[model samples]
Target: TIFLDEIGELTNSAQVKLLRILETKEFFRVGGTTPLISDFRLIAATNRDLKESVLNGKFRADLYFRIAGTSIYIPPLRERPKDIPVLAYKFMMELAQSKGVSFGGFSDDALSLMMAYHWPGNVRELKNFVEKALLLSEGRVIRARDISSYFEEHSEFGRSLPTKFDSSVPSQLIFDNLQKIWEELKAIKMKLSEIETEKKLSSGSETLNIEETEKKLITSALEKTKGNKVQAAKFLGFSTKTLYRKMKKYGLR
Candidate 1:
């Protein structure tokens, strides 16, 4: 697969060239007359709306039609609130394992803060935050302290309120604050229940044998590093020789 990110950023000349290649299934190297036939599936992605770009005359219509053979629209993180905790745990697990740390996962308050915040930077920002938190975390679970730094530095949601409130604050204001607190608590409880269910399901009825778990982890590390055994070995905290031995034992060679 040939993946072109930010397809909308391509220049008009580049777009025309791409269109020609897509039409003729061939391309020419710079300063070379020979046309080279290319046979590969194309997958292009862009945050910009290609249709709008085409209408605005910023993107080539024919090129857009050729590249957008199939399109998938993925909503931003804040739009799909339920996925926050799921993706958080997934990143936590993958990162923790790769770093050779044993993380139990995020605290309820930490997860709540993440869910409440509007992720303008989306999943990439969330992944960076998780990785940073993993490095800074001092315990099994990632608490609000580990995550607050990123939000405070980058998001308005992390700003603090005034130090003091009026002593004569209205009763309605107090009631509203209480109601919001109650709702947050309820949401936390629901998230906790979901995490518990996930943990139980992941643990399964019967635990895998040590060898099985080891092989699985090795395979996962290999896949994550795109079959780079040395990187996978380092990720698993094993020497290259030890990794090779394990792979041979598991018939992974």
Candidate 2:
């Protein structure tokens, strides 16, 4: 069978059999050697530093030589943030169908947060994130807060999960804290409060533009959740649509 994962991760024993097969169209499984013979190709992948692992003796030299014949490296997710939205949408659609929860899709702002993510964990991570997103999505949109749990779970790494949904934390203070975070950023805040009052800019020509304002909010939300806007929005108790509207109002686009 053609392997889709990193070649270096292949077991040393498997490598031995593979090498033998390449040299003499014959091989054996983990056990039972009826001289299984076949003509097949090999493929593997991984994010680990294989060459360094080789020097450190974590990988086999001979096996490396065998698979090295057709090595192909895939770039990490950070270098391709543009692909985040497409992948997230695809995964979300599949997840929704599986769960029978069709909430449409990610709002443009939510997608932006996804794109900004560094994705150190790579595409597999992107898949998990999208699946988990459907779990806490609000209405027709996935907000920054809805994604917080995923990040929290990932950051744990066998250790205790970080504090999330701290019910003891007061609501007003949370909103104020989120607002302070937005105001502290280099951009403007998003959100419209038809509180029967709109502040008129004295200069009107160059008030903090909408895009810049909303960016600050999105950035704050993403940062608070470790680049997970879904959870951030949920924590803030705002629908992803509300967050998006605010983002648009403030020019976070």
Candidate 3:
């Protein structure tokens, strides 16, 4: 079986080559003149809409039709909230067993946050986050604080923005915001590259100072929720106890 992920990212030349192979069931090596025939099942996956790509001339219509013999649409994580806890626990248990650690599973608040999160990165991201949480967790139960810190450290905008369509916001505004976010993400990537280079050149023992970042995130959440710790905790995916501890530690009281 041959599986191609992100098939939509293929160039026109590559697409034409692939289409030829699919149609003829034969392929020639770069330097070889003879064609090689093979019988194999091909499965392709792409996040982009292939129909839109075909209409936009980014993808070949023949190639799209040939490859899309069967289509399966798996909804994003936010769209299927019910599956979050099940997958989260599965990942948590697998990680724990692999690491040879005993875990009591996630706290109620932690589970709530996992369900509430928009999960822009989807199942893979959730699995990674759970693994990281399992590793970082000091107690038997994975707390909301552990996962919240992971989100803060990795999230592009310091929080998971809703991936669902909102009727309240204008379409233009949403597009503008997405554009701005893309630019900011590019800048952030460049900055991170520079920092990584500096770290490699230096001791390599240095790590990101997440204290200030966490403080800023907490403050922002608090401000947005109007000093309501409970609301702030939910927004930041932190337990109320963890939020209070952070507030005290940061002298935000």
Candidate 4:
């Protein structure tokens, strides 16, 4: 049997060669003329959407059909919150045994925070967090504070904001503050427009200050939400796509 990971990343020439081999089940040795018959099972996997790649001309339709006998789509970690504790413990135990640490398990609060997290980087990120927490945690159980810094760092929010969202705070108050910030931003834009009209000059420093304020708000939202982009967007009074575009514009991640 042959297993190919990321088969969609095959070059065009390589795809042609693979297609020929799959069709004939035969190939000549590199330095030989005689064709050799080979039979084997093939399994392939990729994180990319193969059909989309085919549409984009990046993947060959024939080759994709050849290997796509069966396919499985595993949702990302954030989509399956229940799996977080299971995978987190699995990683924790494996890492603890490797490092010869006598750790008991994760605290309930720790697990809760993790479940609420968005985990943008998926399983690998989870494993990394578990390992780091195990190393940092002093007690038998890993507490929320043990792994809280990981979210802040991975969220790429440079400023020190609240470690987690304050659930006790009224949602209406949060929205009111967000609305006020939005209004302030609009006022700044209007001021900048008036200045441009009167002086016929671009206020570079004022524009820089506005950008800095926007970045801070976005960062604070992500930190408070524990890296959950959807929640952060709502907190900032932005559509999810707009938040993503703004994050990209500011090179936040």
Candidate 5:
């Protein structure tokens, strides 16, 4: 099996090349080509929207279709609120044990706070933050004090309230999210501009099919959710049907 950690990172040209390989059982090295053949399963992961990339010509369309013979979208931590406490306690216990330190657990208040806050960085971030609590617990009980530093420094999870240096959680997340989206929109717009200059394809006149639109959303949602749509939609605040309409419009179901 070929585990592609971030297939989205492959350039549009590379994606096109990958498509050719998948369809014809043929491939060539970076420079050498004897019409090589290989047998392997492909698994790719990404936190970027491949479909938007495709629309903007940053990713290849045919390649996405081929790779998506079956797709499993993973949900980010923020969407699975119920799982938060469970994960936190489990990680804390395991983390404590791994450190050879005996611990009871986190205080209820701390646990709720952890659960309430959104983990933008996901499991990797959660695991790292828990480690700090393990290192500085006072009474075998991890408290907010042990982990608040994480939220403050990251600026995604809400910082402590009303403090001189604390950040507003909602505002920070919004600002961060908008900044990324604006940047991506700008990049895609630039690409669109270039495409128009090249092919005279006008955005106002672009007649994109529903399937095509869906594909773009799937790719975009995947990127936003770090390959998770459930969270991405929550981030986008769209209803299921609305999102479905987009997918259908893009031909991405």
Candidate 6:
């Protein structure tokens, strides 16, 4: 089997050669005349929208069909916030091994901040940020304090809110802007829910339960705040009452 990452970037000439190989299941050596026949499976991945590329004449329609045997859509990191901790740990451990250090994992508040942020650069950005955090960390565990500066430096997450409301701007316009942001958040959440359902059906594993993930987040927040439920709830963007209710539901202390 052969795996081609970013196959959408293939040039026209390269695509022609690949298509021929797929069609005939044979190819000649660089300088040999004998045709070499071998059976192999092809798996191609691309971040680009291949269908749109095909319509725009950027990718060949016949080549697209030949390689597109099965397609799986993996949502971006921000949409699947539950996967953040897992991937963070994976990256942290790998980095720690290379540095000859122990992997202490991420503190709850740190993980919470990560889950809340919209990763514009996706997993690669997350990995790079994790490396920075690990390097600057004074201890084994990566606490919120350890990486908070990096987040602020690289993103607008912890930036100050507007001190004064703009009276000149119409209230309705402000409301409409808020509504659009809310709708976008809702859409992302819906996509995550759909992906969770698909994962359960295909893998027969209940690994992506949003409720379970929420429970873990709440537990982490509480731990980070050191039993200050009010602060934890505030940090989590939840009302104290809601936080209490979730703690009760999850049998959290």
User: By TM-score, who's the top model here?
Assistant: 1
Task: Using lDDT as the measure, name the better of candidate 3 and candidate 6.
Answer: 6
Tens digits of per-residue lDDT for model 4, 120-179: 777888888788777777424567877777777766532232224558979898778656
State the displacement of the C-alpha of residue 230, model 6, in Å, after optimal TM-score superposition: 39
Measured over all alpha carbons after superposition, the RMSD of each candidate to the real structure, in angstroms, is: 13.3, 15.4, 17.5, 22.1, 21.9, 15.1
Q: Candidate 3's error at 223, in angstroms?
A: 48
**Top candidate, metric lDDT:** 6
**Which regions of candidate 3 deviate over 4 angstroms?**
152-253
Model 1: per-residue Cα lDDT over 131-193, one tens digit each = 877777742467787778777776774333222334797969876865664454344334434
Q: Which ten residues in a row have the lowest lDDT in candidate 3?
A: 184-193
- Report lDDT (CA) for all predictions: 0.71, 0.58, 0.71, 0.70, 0.62, 0.72
Off by over 4 Å in 4: 27-36, 156-253
User: Cα deviation in Å at residue 248, candidate 2?
Assistant: 39
lDDT (10s digit) by residue, model 2, range 11-98:
7776676677778988666788587878877667777777787888888776667667765665666655555665675466456546
Encode model 3's per-residue lDDT on 113-165: one tens digit a residue: 77777777888889888777767773246678767875566557425455554
Cα deviation in Å at residue 138, candidate 6?
A: 4.8
TM-scores, each model vs. reference: 0.61, 0.54, 0.59, 0.55, 0.52, 0.57
Residue 106 in candidate 5 has what lDDT?
63
**Reference-based TM-score, model 1:** 0.61
- Candidate 6: C-alpha RMSD to true structure equals 15.1
Candidate 1, which segments miss by more than 4 Å at Cα?
Answer: 157-253
Report the lDDT tens digits of candidate 6 across residue range 50-123. 99999999999999988788899877676666567667765764575566543345666787788777776778
lDDT of 3 at 169: 69
Q: Report the Cα lDDT for residue 177, model 3.
A: 62
Identify the superior model by TM-score, candidate 2 or candidate 4: 4
Write down the RMSD of candidate 1 (Cα, Å): 13.3
Worst 10-residue lDDT window for candidate 2 reads 188-197
